[model samples]
Target chain A: MDGNGVSGAARHAAFAPLDDGGRAEVVARRLSEAIALGLLGDGEQLPSEAELAAQLNVATVTLREALSALRSDGLVQTRRGRGGGSFARSPADASLERLRRTLRELTVHELREIGDQHRAIAGTAALLAAERAASEDLRTLDTLVDQLAGAGEPGDRRRADGRFHIELAAAGQSSRLTRQEIALQAEIGELLWMPSGEAVPHPDAVAEHREILAAVRLGDGQRARVATERHIGRGIDQLIDFHLRLARA
Target chain B: MVSDVRAEEMSAAAREVGTALDEVFAWLAELAGRFAAMHASSVAEQNQLRAADLSQLRASIFPRLTGNPRLLAGTGVIVADDVLADQPHWLEWWQHAQGGTELEFLEVDHDPASVGFYDYESAAWFVVPRDTGDRVVVGPYVDYSGTDEYMLTLAHPVSHDARFLGVAAADIRADAFEALLLRAIGAVGQPAVLANEAGRVIASNTPSKIAGSLVHEAEFAGSPVRVVLNQDAEVRDCAGLPWRIAALRG
Candidate 1:
């Protein structure tokens, strides 16, 4: 991918140099996101401390502090001796309780802000896709919607939903949009589909995907954008509602 | 008559690229040959090669193969499903995890039921060579499933005693590979686009034909300035690779 393209651009942003203050926490947060998102696969060896520090543009001491914190959190484990390095340790399931706690920590304003960013990216992707998408791209979108419809578990639903958005962005033929979509999906996709007291409204989600797909197939850019925004808008509302309900509990 | 000369030049340039890519495949074939030999010898000794043995083999060759870090992000061997005694599916792959100095084993879920499962068997890179018994270049597209990088996967089938065993594969970063392609196409000094069989542009000297954009053959059907090279010719070195160079008469 071209460096100016979205995927490359996103990668550049993902590993870009950071500022000094609270550096350890920032590094820890970013690495946490990458692991949870499978950007760093389970049991994958992390770069050496010095190499990682160089890549993240932080001091070796700060990188060590972040790695230690992740180790204590059970997200990373270090082996002693040769072939010994910090490895990502993703559990079989992303803990629902942990997700709930993270959600509870976020303010309504923060949730809304993230939603706005998603809408911007997804909406534009839909609009472009209506004009640019080929038959094969539409077929992929159709399959993802069906996958969402048939998904019986929260994990399956999350996977289907996240892939739909990413595929939609790819259909837009903007690697940049695809990369941003992946980042946003990694950040909030799991949360939106979190299996709580009430299961995520998959039938509604499937219907929304259908609407967006229809608009794209018909080359209705305006309708596609509107449907996409509505879909994301509803998800944001549901997340906010989930946060508030957890607060009450 | 002038168009004939341009067509000849375009074909020559395409062949040059074909030769370079074939050399990469030849290198992978050598690796595959080693893997096949190891598998065969282990079988002859009545002891199947274990995952550890494969991993050790990969680790041994990884450093030497990665001397040109810009051309390849990683390389490894993936055996046929259920071929390994230790696991149903196995990939003994290692990569420079971040284009950095450190090499690490690639971690992927092989479970069919898991959401994160990497179904390499279904992937073109594995399937094409495995079935055809030939080398193949699979992409200049995003690898969302594995490395999450846009890369070209070059692979060759490994076989022993007429039985297919696996594929020796390498991932080439798209940017670096594209630069190589552009250099080849640029040497022809013509406005040209190199596309895969799907008509997806791999690289183009002309801005109108951007990389990753699909080309409609009909759009240039009647244009006298357009010369679709490789329409009927299969460059010998790239016999199994389906790519073409479409050059415009500039």
Candidate 2:
């Protein structure tokens, strides 16, 4: 309403100033970009409603509604007053179902890329986890492995197995590495969670976790690395197989 | 880190954080409104403190001592609950003092359990000569004598060209301050308090019926802050810590 518009911090950092595409579009674009670029950073705060509303030339109600969508998507978190602001987190939507939904949206090529990237990173992690995983951390992995091996239900086994690998990632003993492994694990689990896409992960995902732990426990870094890679590679092969079948059909 | 999956994962994290911050903002605004109401009420009380001249108030309303010039030397006439509890006969003295010209004022000094009253004459009718020997009776009808022991004092020093003259002080009792704080805490009650300059319990509306130990002090996570700084009464974020509502002691 005032001179071409107010290009405040929220405008430049958060909203679209020139196009004046209205508030929702501006906020959506900003939020999407912020997520994509990791600009918000995990645990960093987003601007306040009044700040966003003023920048977008929108009302407080509009800003709040936009935030609600982000909340539903598991992208942002809201707290009440004084220092109320949104926080950013990597893979904030860590739920098994969300991982499935996100993986379902991926192309076969993207799945291959994800698999390759994870193999490279996790190969390094398995090597480190063997050398670096503390006694307590290793015990946590061993206990979960025992649970994974002993679990009754298919769903329970799958969850425990996932937890065992997650423990392995934590055992790697670096926050950055652990965080990255967690994302990769989410990707791997998602590829399997959507049963229609990948059939390989469904067959022996539980057993694969055991092999990796067994190798790591014996202080055999090389075997641990290979077993971890083999398990993940098997999941990738299934995803590729399904993709090919889909094309043929 | 700059990869596609990394990008997508980071995006979700940002969104989660953003949502939580919004909720916190809503909570802070409500607190500001409550302090504003307290500010208005305190301001009105302070004006009454300003109406009377320094000398007149010193002799009549200042916390005087009982007897013996070697001591405070004046049977303290304040709103002490001990004395007000047995009024009517005692208050009948006011109804009949100096052919009956009781200066009007709030009953806090008179009654800790009472709300407030406007007794201007009760204050004006009782001024003694100052060191200057000036006896022109001035008028500050409000009294901050004995109300609830817990009190909020906002002291604005009456100044002269950047010089200190006297002070304009507003005293809100613990009960009145509690009403203001309750409005701020709202339905989802967060423990809240208004501490005085000395960190003494000025007020609290918390529902925890402190059966024994809670006699006067408020319950807090740590020792209360007692320092007075020059700042506006406002709600502020404590860096992901507690959302604090700090009202300046004025």
Candidate 3:
């Protein structure tokens, strides 16, 4: 119909280009991304609405509208008067809470597929290093080698692998650099997609772990870092493939 | 001022006895006020026992004890004149704290006549208004470790509007009174004993020595004729002869 009721027209559809809600979402996401990257540290105040609007090159009203949405998301909070502005709530227990929360996301079938993915990645890494390690490298992984070789049961070897990886993180030297690596290893253990008997960490993984340690001992930061990346990356790739399989299923 | 100078020139023994008696009675009133305020006020709330009340009571009445260190210190023994509680809790509590202060609370159920016995933490027994009170003798009675301890233990009748309440007895410091007597009578370090209505030795300057004997032998050879502490009653005849019968005035 050519005729429109008074104050009832959908003006954006007729002429004014963008959806307001969409524009607000863009502002909200940018702020959230800034918070996630720690571009906004805890206790650091966000700009005033006028200042933010000027920086973002937006109308003050538009900025206010966007900030209102951000406030509702729990990503930022406000205080009053001269000293007050928005700040990030960066909890130190984020990783623990994330793992605790995301656990229910797994299904039984998805779990098994995740287990299969883990085996492929870890098994390949273990295989690759057996032929590549030097003698000293073998010696450096000796403890892990002995542990895997002597493990009384599959469950026992899985624990040995956990210890071996923790030691691997220790070899990294930087405490900050090693924390995520250790947490990821622990999270993998929690997922428990690893096979009970045959899915145990391969026998050669101990030697490879030793080889990586040896490489580091010889002042080979590059090799040590690479080996570790490969080690953790294997677990990560398994996680991705597991998710993919889960989606297909 | 000339009479005042003459008053100061009076016999040391007489002055000592006067000062001692004045201090003892003043202390009695102080103890009474404290009992009424602290001991009795506990029955209700309100620690109406402020310094002003005690200070005024000291200034207005017991002027002899106005500058007294003990009165200022707010320390001394207080025993209720009449027994109310079966077990006197305050005295028992002071015993528990191992505090040296003595407290006595009176109780009824007398053996016969107007006699009362004092029980000490030392397990010694002293009958107040000493020998005259109708009680059997127990010991070299309550041995107090306290110094210069002259005490006046007395029992006198109290009337509430012509109605007689039980006879009231008090254990008061006799050392001050005895010292005043010493000054009054010109006796230096001579012993004196004060027994109340029933003749219990409340305080003695040299009780351990003099209480046993009356210096010169008695004509009767029986027990000494007990000095009775009746209010407003005086015996001038017994003065200067190692014996005294003075009226009890509050």
Candidate with the greatest lDDT versus the true structure: 1
Candidate 1 structure quality by residue, lDDT tens digits, A189-211: 87887642222367888989999
Interface RMSD of each: 2.8, 26.8, 46.5
For model 2, residues A169-222, the per-residue Cα lDDT tens digits are 555543345566666665566445442222343336657777787777776889
Local error of candidate 3 at residue B144 (angstroms): 4.3
What DockQ number belongs to candidate 1? 0.11
Question: TM-score of chain A for each candidate?
Answer: 0.61, 0.53, 0.38
Q: In model 2, how large is the Cα lDDT of residue A96?
A: 31
Full ranking by TM-score: 1, 2, 3
Kindly list the per-residue Cα lDDT of model 1 for residues B156-238, writing each as its tens digit. 78888878788888888877777877876775565777776666667778887777666666644223222222333332232
Models ranked on lDDT: 1, 2, 3
Q: Candidate 2: which stretches are off by over 4 Å?
A: A1-105, A152-155, A194-198, A201-203, B1-250
Cα error of candidate 3 at position B118, Å: 9.5
Q: In model 2, what lDDT does residue B154 have? A: 26
State in Å the error of residue B127, model 2: 68
How do the residues A1-249 of candidate 3 rate in per-residue lDDT, one tens digit apiece?
111221222211111223344366556544543343233444555667777666555677776776786677555678887778865543243442343224336654655554454444333333333323333234535666588768754345656666565444333222222344345445566332232102223554565566666665565655665665565445445444333432332
Q: List, residue by residue over B53-160, the lDDT tens digit for candidate 2.
A: 212333323322111112111121222111122231111110112222332343223332332332321332221111121112111111222221222222221222
